[model samples]
Target: MRKISRGGARQGPGWFARRWTAFWMRFSGPGPVGKLASRLAAWLAPPHMDQISLAYLNRRGYIDATATIYHSDLRLGQNVYLGPGVLVVETKGGGPISLGDRAEIHMHVLFETGRGGYMEIGPETGIHPGCQLKAYVKPIIIGRGVMIAANVALYSYDHGLAPDISICDQPLVAKGPITIQDDAWIGTGAVILSGVTIGEGAVVGAGAVVTKDIPAGGIAAGNPARIIKYRNELKNADKINE
Candidate 1:
């Protein structure tokens, strides 16, 4: 028996050569030489189970090779994709987290569920890189076709501030669930708080802290996000002037 060190000359060179030969042989037309090369490659390195082939991967979702998923109840629909470096976890025996069909979670995203909390992402939703969704005591529901830009944060609970208690020691509280309705667009670095509903077809400006509910078809911005304009209203006004 022989021991092989990590990234050693023997292993590295041999591994690369085998892979290159395998690729060349596989691409070449079927023949005795190709068959022999393919068999050798198979013996050297067997194919690992991919997203479509693995039952666990399919059940949870199409997770990237580099993604980290912790022990949690996850229900994912067909064609859901999780990019590299994504993290999904459930702490304190929380409820199941679900993602609908064709949901795409990009690189470095995180989904965390706290005690008795759950999170749901609707069909065709695309979450960009570095986004986080934390459900501490309530649900965080994102509706269909929602586009969440990079560095967004959605929190379904807030830390309570009591006079006698430290911030860290205080319990987390939530007035209600955080909901982002269908076809909404959340700009980069937006922070959505608990009890807030970003209505259907609404637009949230970049770096906005949403603390209140936005009306349907509204455009909101700034801290404690206020409705700067209504989409339908603006359209109607433009039509009248024209």
Candidate 2:
């Protein structure tokens, strides 16, 4: 009978042969032992390339098997979750991309950063599936506890269309940072352009194209989103009636 080697080879065991035999016996069997063997094999097996790359981002975070993260300066906090098909890319010389603790990025979300541009999502923020976030010259900041619905687009740069140059060739321009303050609710299909701030506790309606800042506790909805009501004001009115 051929002796099983330490490295799973068919050869006579040399040094530390007893240790290898004991280790194999502990993890070899049919029921519970089979389960332990499977787990050990998985743990010892080499991870995929994407998994290896994401390990540099955050050891504590959970990245889906289908997610693709290109070479980037990624800083992910503890308990951060990246869903399947999520694509995160950093252009050459782009700034760091950060996701705070408990930030949940849903499936098929795309995050891109251009040269010198950064993107940050604060703690406990949940970005729904199919969202696109791009930062060219300025930062895109999503504050803590923000809830962003599916298919939303947030851009921190706009293309310049000079009559002298083609629109596609025109240099990207940034008015300022795109800031979505804490506890804000962004509805589905909303497009938030650069230089706009969605204030704390504000709500943006679906399909709105936000151009200007929405005040705190304001509710805005439209093609060019306009403040229709303030949540604090509504609460005050309700108290007066009571």
Candidate 3:
């Protein structure tokens, strides 16, 4: 694979492509300008596969010519944008992959599902470039209005850690699925593990390794992701002062 520089790192062209896609997405909603922008985006970056027709996706949204997708069950909603070099591939015993309306999957982002695993992305959710979501034995469900920054990784399965077993021979296992609730913000380089639920309106700081559930409206950072504060806490404090 060819290497590209992004954000002072070796991340691929995801960030650059996302910037353009997002700019175009702004006007892809409703109205005359939106229609024009939608048409322009479709013309410039149509879906690259014969599996999805130009006419079908043109009415929906834009998909970059460089993107590669191969799934037996793939569902895309209105105004969805898939940026450059995005890849969605099915592995062993894969399941369905669904993207809600206005979902934006940026450049070089990868979605891999296997072992009856699946992925469900809600409306208006934006997943930045260089991010990866791999599901196995469970589903990765991301709710509406979620913002996942670049290089974030969500894995719903892990290898067994038995000491006597060889690393390669160990079976895959999962505590549970990964669920990110509505309006959550996941910062760059975050790693979300299996069995984790990030509640609605929560904020996860950059580079955090989340292993547990983050309550709704909570702000969390650091490894294991402890709640630093809750948004309601600030609101309560303001009411007290008043």
lDDT of 2 at 234: 77
Q: How much is the lDDT of residue 194 in candidate 3?
A: 97
lDDT of each: 0.78, 0.79, 0.82
RMSD in Å for all candidates: 12.1, 12.2, 12.0
TM-score of each: 0.73, 0.73, 0.75
TM-score-based ranking, best first?
Answer: 3, 2, 1
Candidate 3 residue pairs in clash (backbone atoms < 3 Å) = none
lDDT of 1 by residue, 130-233 (tens): 99999988999999999999999999999898999987799989989999999999999999999999899999999999999998899999997898988877
Model 3 lDDT tens row, 1-242? 75545554534455555455556655553345655564455453434332123323344666655667777887888767777688999987999999998788887999999986999999889999899999999999999999999999999999998999999999999999999999999999999999999999999999999999999999999997899999877865466557
Off by over 4 Å in 2: 1-59, 235-242
Candidate 2 lDDT, 80-166, residue by residue in tens:
767668899988767888999878888799999987689989998999889999998999999999999999999999989889998
